[model samples]
Target chain A: MTAVATACPPAVRQGGGPVPVVSEGPALLAGIAQGPGLAAHLNRLGPAPRPSLGALVDMARDVDLRGRGGAGFPFATKLSAAARRRAVVVVNASEGEPGSHKDAALISCAPHVVLDGAAAVARALRTQEVHIVVSSEHPSLRRVVEKALRERVTAGECLDLRLHDAAPRFVAGQAQAVLQLLAGRENLPVTAWQPEAVSGHRGRPTLLSNAETFAQIGHLVRVGSAGYAAHGTAGEPGTTLVTLRGDGWAPEVREVAHGTPLADLLDEAETSRPLLLGGYHGTWLRPAQLRGMTVSRSAIAAAGATLGAGVMLPLAQGRCPLVRTAELVEYLAGQSARRCGPCLNGLPAMAEAVRALVHGEGSVRRVEELCGLVVRRGACAHPDGTARLVASMMQRFPAEVQAHSVGTCRRGREVSG
Target chain B: MSEHQLRVDWPACKGHGLCAELLPEVISLDEWGYPIVHEPVKGEVLAMARRAVKACPTLALRLTLPA
Candidate 1:
């Protein structure tokens, strides 16, 4: 670990000793919100340690740092891959997933923590070129990040950071699409599957990950591996932010330790209705299946579901899940990049078939067949994800499928859709 | 000689279904008329699979061993 000369700009404790705004967690979100400047962050966490590449890689592996983005790929592996033939590091803060605000929350509320992490990773990789990709939907977020970049620059830290505004589309947040967007090309996945770490933006080896992952890297630097591991479970250590959304309540981004019960975060004793784990490309779990689950990735994997990018929303009791499923499928269908025939033709066809079912005029067999055809047939996993959501809807709620099939709802009333 | 798998360059394929027509034994059109390689092209079908790749209008189909 190397400590550079400090120009931390007079530690004044911005809001009188960092009162936690969004969350009061054991890690990252601890003292996240500040009033206006970097004084509070500098005073609280001190300057983030500029660990050498070897040290950062070892620390990442020791603390089990996984990308906070949807895929949750190992950060150490990504770093090591980037070490060879890599020059660029991209901070993906697009936060395009529906009902997901955790990354956006980090960028808006705690910009320094994210910026510090990016600096650490970029410096360790021995490259100063860092690009931050953000969606234009949140002008305020862009403003906040811009302010943070200036603060880091004033602090005499040198990481040539450039922020690019991107369209707020679902696929726009994807790693490949991000590379293309940065290059001023169309934001869509290419037919070829080139590992971004090997050949990324400008055809150089690039280290691209979710914005929150870099924030966690900052946390990992402040509190070394052991301190970082203090909060979460042994298998998956450290705290993670979850954006909780439901029918009655407005969305809230809460930072909780890994291995916390999924039910506990839902703020309910137990829900009888189904839940959507991960984001749209995630899984649908029946109440019984989700009851025993924790936030640990391995635990979720043990049950054959990925705890993807952490968007938890339970279907309200009164609402028909199939109706929601149909709506979600249509949304996902519209999100397809339209690069391939299977996704282009299959998604719209699947959407129509699902819409027909919701309106009481399609077969379960037909929907299943469409799901069968669309899986693994795209440039990206968009079609497969949409199909998985549909399949899970069918599996989790058989009675709902039956009711809609006979031109009636689960309540035995006429299917009103 | 190395064995190669029949594959589709997803973003390029326009669903012309010519690959399906030329190599029906290995490639078949799905409900959407997109080619789905049912099995690996081997022995007897290898020659036909090469012809199918050459026949694709958009040059979207490939017969290459995956790396």
Candidate 2:
């Protein structure tokens, strides 16, 4: 019951030119190439029929549909957890991850798909209210969502859809943080005694999922589990949207089937360089680790990395990976909610240590020690994620670390000496 | 009987550091004066941990069993 006075860090606008939807499969982004509108959405994927709660759960379970959000929790498990009580469907469109834009892309290019998914979830849970939470920084996305909701109403959908504007912060998109915003409280995360699915949004059962997850649900309902599972691997089914970076321009949001090879999305010439799978908080994959790795969750997990928010940034040649990692760590440290001690203290300390290492003024052992202290010590996963990024950089770039320590850098520059 | 564990509601904790002082074995203060709990309270220290929980100024510290 303590109120800590903390200022919201200014939102870092995601760079990368307009992300285009490139899909191998015909679901989710079916008519994106032809410029999808409400009409196009309706024509490509017809109006969704209200299915029973049991049926929706069965479909999710049958396809093993995991949330498109970073954690990849199964959708069926979350749905069944909320089935016992009056529930509210929350569409988490707050795309705050720096290199992730699939949610915004979905809302902008195919708002109907997202709306249809939200409405479908509401109908399944027998709740009339569906709240789509987007960042206040993106006014255009808000307009698109509002217009799409109106379009759905005009088309005779009876679900009550609302748009909520969240302050643009990294952790603001976390489940608890979003729920706090809906509760008219400060948009900060709290360690809930009960899961949100059990008691949330005014103590009622709430099913909150990523925007792409809802669109996938809309896709799932339109096409049965068998059809949705047609393209992806056995473990992870359906086509997923990915924000692909480091191909010479801003990251492009592309839709690829689950089993697509990592090589397919990346530049073949740059395969020798380290590939950053997931966004800033995700792990780095060496070229050797990329072999035989597909885009599916199981495959990526087997490769010791996660397809976190499905972001891939191939580090450009001639750029120092450790320097890039230090820069991102600094950004993540600044984005902390500043409520927790580890995040407030540990992150800045670790960021400074990494910066010193980059400039040949710090020790690798000190950076590692700081990372160990920061992991699992914060209220949210922000500290843990930052540690993961730093740890992975240390593991993957030993040569670079040795070079940087001696006052030289991989980019062939005397950064310190 | 289920074993008691020490937990901190981090947002509520303003680094009062009473828990570390009262239950030195189970809790230690970080560089910023916040408690870094060694979780899963041992049977011998459960009483002192309870005292620490009661002694917290902000009531940010709690003793609970695993759910």
Candidate 3:
């Protein structure tokens, strides 16, 4: 296979990091991109004082702040549910999703803002305990968060904030897994009929959200729901942070209004090529499928894909999509938590089938069968996500699959590893 | 008559296949030997499904009222 070098757009680096771009809206990123320490955060966003629990819930409902984690559950519902009992707020900074860098970016640059959001939720719940769970794998992020916490303490914020280090597995970032880690258990998901919001983190109620979600909460409280809603579409209000990658361009974490066109971040010329929207667990959108599509969750869903975790990866040209998909499937197989038989056996089997397809030794029917068997059979969503991604690749690129089986590939070469 | 459904706590299940052997009417073992319930439990077979749930060595099987 031809390993053509992908061209990346030059990014303006601020304070040794990529500056967040806010195109066509007010900036929620405000002062965070310049690697601002706590002082700049205070100056820009000010201290996030806790509103009453009732008021916070009302505002969350009014603005409809969904969880920034891959699953877009309504934040208000989660908060109100957990608030019924003594609840702890958890800031899920353990970003293990491939192609997602917004969480770590927020932690490193504007950690206090994230802390402010967490503190707001804690106050609303009338709990001083707030846990910030970061992956132990990221020492730099740990240091940055610790430094931010110290700054918050020195500022006399009445928060019982604790920093926790969790194993960096993709499933480990799930709500149950994060809660388990916080309770000194292994970072693994457990099947439960009840939502974690009702009983979590040592069986007490818990309000957990992604770092970016908390940051948006801080932004929302600061700007109010109306001001936040002023920027994005009617359905999905407020700005969102998206990790825009692919097409040989340096992946950028951009803060754009919810309804910003996908074409704004990706080249319109390249939109015809299959774009891997969201991350690996996300879906592929065909060229015509993405035309006039906005980056909102509803808009992306309307295009037959999810805006999962707010990741946008447009496939670069001249690359074998099947080969890339096979490689990703292999990676995903390695990432399986192995908590369920279906995920353990099914993902690797599907990956192997894809590998065979990439080598022109397999048929599309085999892949489809594997996907049907794998989806919805795991303890977590990993297997289902992998199945969705693979299914989308097959659905969006049937011609490519047909060509691959005929001993020819779009790249016109054996792309097999 | 109250309708019931079979559920498996996948992590707790160890592919013992006892559930399938006992209640083959609804549960069958996949290629890997894990039990896959073909349909929800209903009618007089509910007692048989309960017996299989009790027979599961890992205690991963359960019958619950359909939501």
Candidate 4:
């Protein structure tokens, strides 16, 4: 609703890509070597009474952890205010952002690590049902995760986790939309209801957080807040898993310490051009400003954007910013569930405007009007966020936008032909 | 909140308009015949909201509380 940007706070720019070696904590590798998760891990912890809602709150607070899910809400506060005891735990594994491969990659590589996190949180919250919500694209991930949970049962791990197939549409990955589909309703719904936290399953409480967040939770528990806080910035501690895609980069999942500099990650990717931070729903940063830009959620927010889902994409110099930005906007629009009045009506209109700009056939008036309609009107941030991204591109890359406008850009070539 | 709201899945609405007839104070039909409920529901409207919800001939209308 309001464009708010805070000036620089704490920041860090580090080397290495995602999956940076976590030097502290209980050693996730140790847990991995035990070769027993769910049940074995539970057995190892042994009869530890589930932390009181209060105790769990304290741990979350002590760690200063935030939602690894894009919002970055304080985990402690989310736990405290969320419906307690009766809440359902939804592990978001949709991995819908084209630039985002972190969730699926994590589950594929270390299924048990994620499971340990899910189990720990559910146990801590005393929730009986844990749903693993994944997309149809990653069928193996679903099967493997399910099989891993099954194995945990043999080791006496509490087996309350269920694998749910969420509609693979991009909009379905939004937190509320994901819940609606899990409720056995259409993936696209007009209203927002709390399924996992409120009236979940048979109308109980629900705690829906992303798969990565749960993995972080698992790390926090094994290492304790103090150990987990050892890496990264003081304001933002621990490791972050990001999906690194684009030029000169090893296209793989990476683990980096929190507050790693954006410049460093791009250097790891070897990207020589501008970078698109935060995925399609994220912002595009020019090469010059990359220096000293940190990766913490707050730091990015201060820069008027976020590192959503920790997605890092690079746009080479030869690539036209206008074309790339337009394509991404249209891609995001097509992903909308078309439930709300604004998303359904607004997105397509914005898409057309972007297309016209791409072809050098758009008017400034049309673009401005479409952008205005895209905010605060959807069940999720898909429409609003996409609009912001496109609008920001238009604002920040004025030279490119003007080039397209005056028929001197790539879009003008088609017109001349 | 005495006044309540009625929502229809536009795809499911089928333009039944039963809610409009059953609860005029809250609902009005659109040009195409779909029901548009304009009344803001409050605490006291829960009973009426429930009635309207049940009365929808197509079962498209629902009464929901904010979380």
DockQ of each: 0.82, 0.68, 0.72, 0.13
What value does the lDDT take at residue A311 in candidate 2?
87
Compared with the true structure, what per-residue lDDT tens digits does model 4 show for residues A1-417? 011112100011112223211111223333333333355555555433345567677888987777777777777776765546576778888867766766765565455667777777777677767888877665555666676777877767764778887776677777766776777887654444443455555566667788888877766766677888887878777888776672124444566787777665556433456678888887877665566777787777776778778887787546777778877877777887755555666777788888788677887678877676656544577877888788778766777777777777752343332
- On a 0 to 1 DockQ scale, where is model 2? 0.68
Q: Candidate 2 — what's its lDDT?
A: 0.81
Cα lDDT of model 2 by residue, A347-409, tens digit: 999999999999888999989888888777766788999999999999988988999888898
Query: For each candidate, what TM-score against the reference?
Result: 0.90, 0.93, 0.91, 0.77
For model 1, the docking class works out as: high
TM-score of the first chain of model 2: 0.92
Q: Sort by lDDT, best first.
A: 2, 1, 3, 4
Q: Is candidate 1 or candidate 4 better by DockQ?
A: 1
> A308 in model 1: Cα distance from truth in Å?
0.6
Residue pairs with clashing backbones, model 1: none
Cα deviation at A240, candidate 3, in Å, is 0.7
Query: What tens digits encode model 1's per-residue C-alpha lDDT throughout A123-171?
Result: 8999999999887656666777788889888889788889987777787
Docking class of 3: medium
lDDT of 4 at B36: 59
Candidate 4: misplaced stretches above 4 Å?
A1-50, A83-85, A193-196, A199-202, A246-250, A268-272, A410-417, B1-67
Using TM-score as the measure, name the better of candidate 3 and candidate 4. Answer: 3
